[model samples]
Target chain A: MTRPAPLAAGISAAAAAGRRAPVLHAEALQLRFGAVAALRDVSLSVAENEIHAIIGPNGAGKSSLLNCLSGFYRPQSGRVYFDGEDITQLRPHRRAAAGLGRTFQGIQTYPSMTARENILTGFHNRMRTGVFGALVWWGRVRAEEEAFTAKAEEIIEFLELEELRHAVVGDLSYGLRKRVDLGRAMALEPRILIMDEPMAGMNPEEKGDLARFILDIRDANRIPVVLVEHDMEVVMDISDTVTVLDFGEVIAVGTPREVRENEAVIAAYLGTE
Target chain B: MLPTGVLFETYSAEAGLLKTARARVAVAALVLALLAAPLATGAYLQGVATHMFITLIAVYGLHVTVGMAGQINIAQSAFVGVGAFATARLSEFGLPFFIVVPVAALVTGAVSVVFALPAARVKGFYLALTTFAAQVLFPIIVLGLPTSWLGGLVGLAVEPLTVAGRPMNTPTHMYYFTLALTLIASYAAFNLHRSRFGRALKAVRDNDVAAEVMGIDVLRHKIMAFFVGSMFAGVAGSCMAWVLQFVTVESFTLFTSVWYLGMLIVGGAYSPIGAILGVAFITLVQEGLHELGTAILRSGAQEAGGAIFAATNIALGACILIALIFEPRGLAHRWQVLKTGLQLWPFPHR
Candidate 1:
């Protein structure tokens, strides 16, 4: 696909999905680490097919909220409901199994594994073959593995990683590693894809590619995306709703244009600490 | 790694050990050579080759835990000992070696899980220390027990493996027995790494938190790696018991475990073939040095044998240190790089 032009208006994924329903809900989440509060009464809703962007300055609890929502951090008081079920006490892997996939800002792709193998690891939980079955590598396990590899191949093709499919991921450039991380997350077939700084270090060309991929995920896959990005250009172009955070609290929630015009968001971005 | 011209139409064909027509012929030739080893080689060389097969089996276990899964195990020999002793006891009960092998493997796997329980929480040096406890305690428990039960320091003599109601007394018979198990164990280890469990274990080894986010139970995979690795050790131990016709704490030591780690580093930790190559390299070097020391003493080149023997130990240590400094990824990886370079010819291939 050619690089798509920047979106002119805030085209919410809701518009493409043709309906709106809160698929992921975080209500009154309050998290504290000893004395300092990382998040205080942070509440957010990710509607179906919406690209919800969480923007904040440093120490503004953007990651803290994502952690709580993804079940990495438990809130002191409150719950996270996913698809109408309370998942507050569930573990991170359980939450992931429940269809919440995420990419780490630090790039958590398996370094020693190949680009294709790293993507295949994402489908690990989906396979029913146990260790004994795998050791045997009989018909059932062999079929399961072939099926998973076929799926990984699709992701590899989608990310244009055909040439680098056998290359060790640790040897890949930072931009490529981030892209592989996105592919692995995508392989999880998540109901809600959460990404932290998906374009932190990419050049403009790579950023455009990533932007198009994110749009494809929203438009083609129709999965809701909750992204924490510092790149304002990306936030304004793709995100349907921009939730601005300041001092561990939500300051504004609106369309990108309205968020840009909010007095409180402007003050937090360019005003006193 | 594949030759540049080779390609596959299916995942099964792609993942196959022998992908090309030439590879198939080469593997068949290798199999014929192995099967004909007893006929061509002298008794001593055949014995050495058989021992190599057994060591390769245990090293494959180490490859899984320390190499692939990145879980350090310093008590591999203890698991081997568990198998050996289990086999010695089972054989006395009039069980066949076939039944004895799997039972010993299961017992050893269970024993390894006892030490591996801490692996769920601890990693790296701490995990090694936990396994170290198993290494230290294995001998103590064997020697500390009653002389009649575990045979104490006197050790327990295992009956020679019997085939079709006949005792397998000859070294050639032992060689065939071991080669068969080694092939099966190697096949199992190879398949384990390519399976879903292998992917889960590798994911945990690489970035466990990310693995968890990918919906893998990190603790379960780590424990499974230990269970499977130790079971390989068990099968090796059973073969060892039948070969030596004995079980003794002196045979399985911390040094043996350390040497297994060294062999893994020397060969290449990633592939099962690497594990075999590592065992071959280390065993040949040690045996070759030992023969040289004995020959020098016999030729009266050295006033005393003790000095040359000590030097041999130093030289062995030096070889491992040099290998780490130079080919850190192991011989198998260096071989791949060489092949890839040859395929590229004069041009750089990264």
Candidate 2:
């Protein structure tokens, strides 16, 4: 398999100096629904191969931020750049084709499909087969399908979901479905993966497993992750950097320890002073 | 699930169409039975079988749109009309059966794309209404054309299908033609369901927003769904023209489209076999009711003719309603249950 092109156009010496270029850059994003502002001038950057957590209390626009980055919600103002290319105007699928992948706040696996099929869908953009090729099922389409199935199996193993690979996703537990969703996103082989509330309803153990997977995604897969998570302990434990949002605005941006000790983040999470 | 005691060591084995030895034998026997049907069957039964195969093809077309891609296509019959009319025109030009069929499919597929474009902007009831407009518009367009083009409401007479300079108009020949085409269509559909293209469409059906975010290009796939569907309809329409040797607006009606949807529901929209089963059940029921209606009229119950005539429609509606309420997944799921039971007979349950 060919390596994915670096998220940034030019992974320069400056980037190689441990000060990597931001793979995804959000600039002063402002989103409004009717008269209500969902996100107000929220800007954050996710660097190469790092877990950048977007954390905040309810209605703080963490999800809105992830939505903008993932190209779901078009912000009223501000631009999103990936690999130095502006992508604010790209549609969700286009952005996905451009190597942006995401998981929904709600699990979005094709319920009737098996876990293997669900994960295989994540490789949608990568496959080169068209309608005729798929119908005929030979040559390029066949080879690519075999390769991708192998890749999907590898991801299933990585997530420890080999047993659940052929199981219908709808019949699986919520936690397993969530893992399947992640595996699907991982199949996209995204340059940067954005997840919405990966551990929202998980038990502590499941949360731990998911957090480890997120870290492995960053460190081992070398893909940057933009995680919108609410659990503070998991956030602080896994995040290389944390950007705190409060009422549609970015209140703090720093390392996990810095954000945890920040006065504003404490106030936002635990009632204002 | 893997059949009771069966295990697959390779991906191909796991993904094979028939799993256990029993399944292979059953499929083989079924194919042999179908192939030898003409030998045992008379002309009337052969015609019924031929019509069933044609409806099976059409219903499978509807399945691709309504079942696989989750698009509601009320214009299915209209697209079929596109094929029928195109075949009428192409056959009029002295094209061979083999050539005319594919050309009809292509023409209908293109027309389907026109109908499908509205799907890029709208869906559900609104999308259904959009295709409904096509359904309303198709017959008018055909009848409005110059007699030289479409023959108006009188319709056009189709030339006999020929292969290699030999007439294929006999019941036996037509049966083989329909069966061969149906087999090819079913094979293509079967492969498509497991292929990347089909999976992408199924993803779109399951959740369009999720499919889009996953980079499936929902609009493109929706268009593709319509194309494949109408292409199937086109092929079916070609077969229909061969069966009737006549093309008329009355043959392709809005009611027929609805009946096709009913067939998909009864058959299990997601399964090709369900399409066949649904077509077989619904067509046989309609024929049975037709005979009943005739018998009622002959027995001096002339007034009951109208009621008996409406029985087919009522029966179709009831079948759809029952399937939706009690077995929304359709007969395919039920078949799976039965197969599982058989596979694990002594074991009782999985």
Candidate 3:
């Protein structure tokens, strides 16, 4: 039995209407940096087509949880499972190869590269061309490159980045660069997309555009999104399942309205007010 | 760039190497002229052109390592020396220059990886020091090897290059051979920039953390840049050895490596054409000024001419700085700007 979707009036991702097996999950993760515990026994699961949102106050271990799940940080005692396979020991790029796509908290794009080239690099794990093969550029290599270029263009088209295709990302506005970062992650064609504060600093219009793109990605691409966001409005508007974290531990997990009313989450945010 | 009003429906057409009729015609003309110049030029000019070809290939390697991959390689000339020594030893086995060149490149590339192993882990000044260690070790290792191996103090003067069982020792022969290989090396470097390897390399260069999160193995791509860059230098070394009919460690010193980097900077590092333009521009300036100095020393106005020529030497030495001052991106970037102006004619600003 699942909670009612009283707030699921917007997006198409059902709130447990037809939930499948979890596509990505972190089980009992415990990460420590020296004496400080960044995450302790944190666990969460994301199913297909679900927009799973992780919301927390600053210093609440949201990044640590995302890092542990994305293979950037190894939990001292836990396991990460994707498609029912444990991938705890995998490195970041290795996990990426296994379809773990991620976007950083800031504008972490290839500054010197054009917007399109930046997105094309997101297809790194998908393609199989090596140094020699790429250097030689035979028929097969050219074909592979053209196909990647087309795929990258598709991402650019969806992001409405046709004009910025040739512009170097470093020269673009901050909002545009953030959008390019998202487009690049989309270019990975990840089964489950993990975004770290995809809208940390943005104008209202850019935030609306990115939110729309996120919904389009879920509806059209069928990729589940695990978003670590500070914006409560955007989180409540998009997320199907909400997990509230505080001080390196999960405090509450439920639907948006349920977590919004949860006494612990209220205390964590407002502190006995 | 396409014509002002032109548009392409396909990405392939938009990304074509020669997108315009003018570029195609220019490439054809340049090829025809290069093939025809050897016939019309004197032996001295041919010899100088052959030398420029060697420098071009070396600079191409630097462009990849320093330019695209953002790996600082001041010891590229050391890698070139490794290639030369390797080619000399390979030639003693009586293989043709064709088989020998590729093998020498691989040997040099592998040698570069030894340094790249440490270099790849570091960045900026530390990486420079790592490559510098390669340069510092090159002469010591070469000299420390048995005198019987590749001639410690004394260099190797192997057999001349052969084609159809005949020694091709003429300047024209050397020029044509170096020209062909230089073109091939250029093509390979160009293709590297166009394809996925280059994108990955640039990604690592611009931001390694971002690159890693994007599924690129940053360390591997950095090492790959060094390996491929050294291979180009190795091919250049092979060309240098066969053309000069000798191999000497002195020919590829740290000073020479610095010059190769200088050429890459002058040409612009990001593109293959920049390598060519940079190498040719610097070579012409140096050679032309040398010829003028020699002429002035023998002229009627000896004292004044000598003073003027000495000033000219300082000016010529400062030309690279001057070029950088005017066009910080290098001559290739200036060329791009000019072409963009051509594409956007009737409007001076872009």
Candidate 1 CAPRI assessment class: medium
| Proportion of native contacts kept per candidate | 0.81, 0.73, 0.80
> What is the C-alpha lDDT profile of model 2 across A1-273, one tens digit per residue?
111222233343225546878788887789999988989877677788888898888889888888888788899988788898899999999998999979878778899899999999999888888888877777666678778888999999999998888898999998999999999999988999999999989999999899888888877779889888878888888888898888888888888988888888889888864
> Model 1: per-residue lDDT, tens digit, A156-256?
88888999998999999998999899999988889999999898988999999999888898887899999999999999999998888889988888889
Q: Residue pairs in steric clash, candidate 3?
A: none
Candidate order (lDDT):
1, 3, 2
Q: Write the per-residue lDDT of candidate 3 for residues B91-193, one digit (tens) a residue.
A: 8999987799999999999999999998899999999999999998988888889988878878888778888788889999989889898878877887887
Q: Pick the candidate with the highest lDDT.
A: 1
- CAPRI quality of model 2: medium
Pick out the ten consecutive residues of candidate 1 chain B with the lowest summed lDDT.
B303-312
* Predicted model 3 interface RMSD: 1.1
> Candidate 1: lDDT of B327?
83
Error of 2 at B64 (Å): 0.3
Assess each prediction's global lDDT (C-alpha) against the native.
Answer: 0.86, 0.86, 0.86
- Cα deviation at B113, candidate 3, in Å, is 1.2
Worst 10 residues of 2 chain B by lDDT: B8-17
> Which lDDT tens digits does candidate 2 get at residues B1-350?
66546886656556667777887798889889999999999888898889888888888889888889889998888888888888888997898887898899999999989878976579788998998998999988888889889889899899988889898878988898999998888878888888899999999988888999999888899999999999999999999988888999999999889989988898788888788778888888888988899899899988897689977688878989999999887888898788778768888956
Deviation in Å, model 1, residue B68 alpha carbon: 0.7
TM-scores of all models? 0.94, 0.94, 0.93
